[model samples]
Target: MKLVGLSRQIVLSMMAIALGVTLLVILTSYAFYFLWRIYWPEQACEDSWIPTGPEWVWMIGATICGLALAVVVAVNLSRRILVPLNSVADSIRRMAQGDLDARAVAGDRSLGEASQLADDFNALANQLQRVTEEQAFWNAAIAHELRTPVTILRGRLQGLAEGVFMPDESQFRSLLAQVEGLGRLIEDLRVVSLAESGHLHLQVREANLAAEANAVVDMVGDALQARGQRAILELDTQPVRCDPVRMRQALLALLDNVRRYAVPGQVRIQSHAKNGWCELSVEDDGPGVPEDFIPHAFTAFRRAEGARSGGSGLGLAVVAAIARAHGGHAECRKAAGGGTVFTLIWPDLPETGLPGSNRSGRA
Candidate 1:
């Protein structure tokens, strides 16, 4: 039923009940006065006795007027409270029935607690909708990303099985490369998923941040040389509390990104400690990212218009996840000397000398 009318009906019904009780009380008082007159006739005429009939009528009329005023107030108050409450209840029902967009009526008339309730519910609904959209997008993106590599692997293996392609060492190496790519992609996905769920495992300890960066640089040194590029270290010996394995993984991802897309020049790996924070960055020369795409550079499976097509587009996203898991974040920007720089920054927590630490010494 319409809440306004329902409120009015409720007020009137309650007023009717009150009026009936008032009449019954008046009749009972009149009967009691008659009984007193029969039992003790002299006291019936006492000045302090019950009022006369006209006075009784006046008192009853005043009481009815007061009740009428109370009905008006009650109706207005009930509408203010009940209308919005019903609206919220209806919205909740709609949302429970799978309407993520459903929202309560929140307007000037929705006053006090009702207004706050509507605002909170709308905020929750908006969050649920955004999360649902992101989940759907991730599902589709994961399937699309897996299909190409799986197709390549299947095609190669089938050809070999059917004797259509020679099983030579070169062919085997190609197959192995595809398998390795699949493995890396799967691991990247796992890291991202865990990070998103706030369960990414970390063996956090006091370690040398510069050492981790140097280790990644050393490991990828030969690969960059093969690609006609070299690494330049401007590292500082800075200690930080973090998971060494994950930190190395993030650094390697950044360097791999550089190796894949950066121009054939010096790739700089830098580390520094300032303002109670540690920064590890990989900078390259020339061919910077487009200005407009910088904001979304760390989003999963996102690529710039002119980016190389070989990457699975999860490297920077994985870097961001790793940074977040380390109680920090990742960012990308253009270097002053013209190139893209991706940096992982986190707090430099106070040193706690944990045992079995992977604390590589100063760079």
Candidate 2:
């Protein structure tokens, strides 16, 4: 009985109640008949031996029919509501086991409030799954990027201090370079942590997404040229409501990534408005991220499986977190021309028209 559905329980309860009422009615009728016969045969139901037993027989049969009717009505009504609940429960169970694609099997009909709840649940789960996977990749990349510099510096310093070789100027210069690399790695980690922790303050104001892209391009232009790469800026004329400082931070992180992978290549920054949201994108012309690794590229400490780069790998991770903090999302995927494309999506807003608003040149 417990294993059976709620509809069954409802139907049974309705039938039981109906049967009890019918039995009570029949008993009251028989009691009245007996009292009349005993006190005055003249008024004994207008006829002596009126066959009350036959009347009771018909009443008992009607009682059974009423119970059956109650059962049918209860079943139809309860099943309509309970089935959707069961379907949603099943879908939730499947999803809990990691089936992100699992959706509630609401039939040809909807479940009203429950239907909305199921929809919200599935959406939240899907987003959470993507974020979690991104986090893992980023953590691994950070480890990979930070480990390289620290490992190199430690190995070189040990060799020098142990007097394993003559203290030559060339070796001393190598040591100096390693120390500088380590310093850069530490700073990158610090920035990445701040962005991810959501403790960093945001000075929100109206700004142009396109201009922000151009500014990031200018800042990283020199670095790209030094590495034999070029950065091209293209911006949409649309304005957006955002923090210029935070936006630049995200852009700088992305450009840094471009420098690492697109050496001897080029990066193009483009912005446009789409479906009420402004999009800012930076595309690179490097060996595109592999089919599997693209999903994890924005994750901190994620190194392309066997991919090499200098300093720390927190650049993309920081960009993603900063974008999210500003009511936007950062995404990276395989791009045309066999490279990666990263896009930032945010709500479109009018510029605040404030003076000296640009903060990209601050650092």
Candidate 3:
């Protein structure tokens, strides 16, 4: 029914009912006038009221003309409103049936409201086309990324099993590592996609900027310890207003970047608050970014040459996206000790501090 054309029988039936009512009204009203004349006495002046045969015929003709006019009016109105609506309806149906090229074309003088609607419909169709193209590109890129690792693992396993190569533990471990890298890349891609697309539901709550940084600090504590590194938390303002989960994700991404780039014993988490906004900075002793590379760092799949960065190149991109989604930004600067300092600021504060108290989380 959605794909089919509009039902003409339904439309005509409605018009038939309307015409029938008009006929009934004309006949009943004139009939009453005729009966009234029959019951009343003739006028003293015959000129004043005459019940001639021709007058009756003229009155009957006029009634028929009025009824005909009423029917014409009803039919035109029904066609003007319903027919255009049906055309737009048909266009929608075709579009829903996967006809990407379908468009709802509206004729002018159609209440003008439907013209606006058709404009919206055409705009949506154009957007769908663009999205379809982008999705195709994204799929191709992912397939290429996946195939590289798979091909390597497959070749290595085949060689080992067929005795074409010696059963070396290091060789097998390398292959396994490649496979694991692919897996991590896929997962990180998924996470960044969801986070950037605003599909990751945020559990917004008040949390301590220092404490949140410290927790991520704790998670990486062992790895940093193994490298003779330590995390320092210095927050002048205790609590910051924002969602804990999302903010933590941003911080973790930054921390991961710092670990990959900075020297050991170079981690610092410092924060400051002024006006309504609070900012927390994560600085490290890593080499500062080249001036030209600073702007490109936040783009997905972008990395500096010789950076030796592990994980998907989505860390900084995700951090940027998450910050903007929360109505703020992530800023980069040179640390006091000459490492990179990334400050995540909260420009907007919720009226009620949610989930956790921002005041208590201060170190």
Candidate 4:
């Protein structure tokens, strides 16, 4: 009943048709024999009820016709079911061979599980294509970012070696700075990789959120002052369990982003408990991010038009990674007054009196 691994529906249909034809043949033959015996008793008394040659011919012909009909129906049904599956298999094969653009085309009549399978395959193909494109972009961006600092270091070293440039303190300091920048870029890439791969090392302990925020502000205070910018802190004293060093690193990244992108205005840092989460936010009163670019703001190597400085664009991405490692998340939004606000939220730790508790003063 099965032809070319056809669907169960087709197999069952063929079986039913064959069975019906067999019953019809048997009943019709017996009925004809009974009529012959009733009309001609002498033939019946001859003691042979076996089918004569002409009667056998009629039954064979009917059976052949019925089988032909069954064969036609089975073939047609198999075609209807197998054609789409074949197309899907071929498309998958092409995709496995690196043709990300290959896609399965389901026929208009395809329904039920076959249609769903086609839809799922197409969706997976689209996702793979997108990831491939993003990987290409990452490679290009990283190369460009590394090339600048490396080129500078190489040129400076060559000049010094050839006596074209003097080995003065200032010259050496500049070279050292370029080397440091390159090292930082490499380290940032490592951090992002670790975070994405769920291998980032975290030393979790109870720490005061306010103290951490103030420390971060103090760390970046000089830069803000040089830019003629003022930072305000409104931290709520709360003890949260997190890796203090990693948390500070995340805060520093956010501060660096503000320093690089935001205009000279009042920068606000706030931390407070909201709902079941503790939220830490950095807000500025300068030009805000564009609406269209907000979604990709945290992506590595992504920069807005206002980002003209020499940045590798991994600052916010690292922040996001750290937040996720802490069972939290980061978000960017337009600040109410102006400019943009970046928020990091983590689940609130249970109330406990730790060493850093009761320290609520702002910096």
Q: In terms of TM-score, which candidate is strongest? A: 4
Give the winner by lDDT.
1
Encode model 4's per-residue lDDT on 50-98: one tens digit a residue: 8776578778877887888788877776676666677789999998898
How would you encode candidate 1's per-residue C-alpha lDDT over 85-130 as one tens digit per residue?
A: 7878999999999999898876434355666677788889899999
Is candidate 1 or 4 superior in TM-score? 4
Minimal lDDT window, size 10, model 3: 354-363
Candidate 4: lDDT of 189?
A: 91
Order of candidates by TM-score, top first? Answer: 4, 1, 3, 2
The CA lDDT of each predicted structure is 0.81, 0.70, 0.70, 0.79
Clashes of 3: 0
Q: List the residue pairs that clash in candidate 4.
A: none
- The 10-residue segment of model 2 with minimum total lDDT is 354-363
Error of 1 at 272 (Å): 1.2
lDDT of 3 at 167: 85
Is candidate 1 or 2 superior in TM-score? 1
Root-mean-square deviation of Cα positions for candidate 3 versus the true structure, in angstroms: 9.5
Worst 10 residues of 4 by lDDT: 354-363
lDDT of each residue in 20-96, candidate 3, tens digit only: 76776677768756765776446322563656664577578767876776677667766766655776788889978
